[model samples]
Target: MNVSVELTFTPLQNEYEPPISAFIKRVRASGFTVLENPLSTQVYGDYDGVMHMLTKEIKNSLSNIDIGLFQMKIVKTDRSSYVADF
Candidate 1:
């Protein structure tokens, strides 16, 4: 099955940019479909593939920090093609 994931990583340290930027960069290099906005990141791919990559990356990211947060939302279908019409 395919899936879409939205991830907002907040590192609660004094200097927050490096970890968040590193996480996004690593996820982008993960070869999955990725979209980024100022607030969050979206990744799309097969369920297993996406989850596997996230698992590795998330662990690696959080492990390096003293405190952090990962606010994640998951959908069972890919929403990368969604175009806003208003």
Candidate 2:
């Protein structure tokens, strides 16, 4: 199965950029389709591959921070190539 995931990482501390930036960099190196905006990041790839990468990376991110929030939404299909046609 293939999937798309939207992720938002918010670290509840003063210096938040480092962790978030690091996370984004690592995700980009994950070899998955990654889309980023100011709000969140979207990743598209095989379900297992995406999940596995996220599972490891998310944990790494959390462990580096004292406290943080990881918001995620998993879609049944890949929306990486989606375009607005409205």
Please provide TM-scores, in order, for all candidate models, with all chains considered together: 0.97, 0.98
- Put down candidate 2 lDDT per residue, 3-83, tens digits, no spaces: 999999999999999999999999999999999999999999999999999999999999999999999999999898899
Candidate 1 TM-score, true structure as reference: 0.97
Q: Report the number of the highest-lDDT candidate.
A: 2
The list of candidate 1 runs beyond 4 A from truth reads none
**C-alpha lDDT score of every prediction, in listed order:** 0.96, 0.97
| Cα shift from native, residue 71, model 1 (Å) | 0.5
Worst 10-residue stretch by lDDT in candidate 1?
Answer: 18-27
Where is model 2 poorest over a 10-residue stretch in terms of lDDT? 74-83
Clashing pairs in 2: none
Deviation in angstroms for 42 in model 2? 0.5
RMSD of each: 0.6, 0.4
Tens-digit lDDT track for model 1 on 46-85? 9999999999999999999999999999999999999999
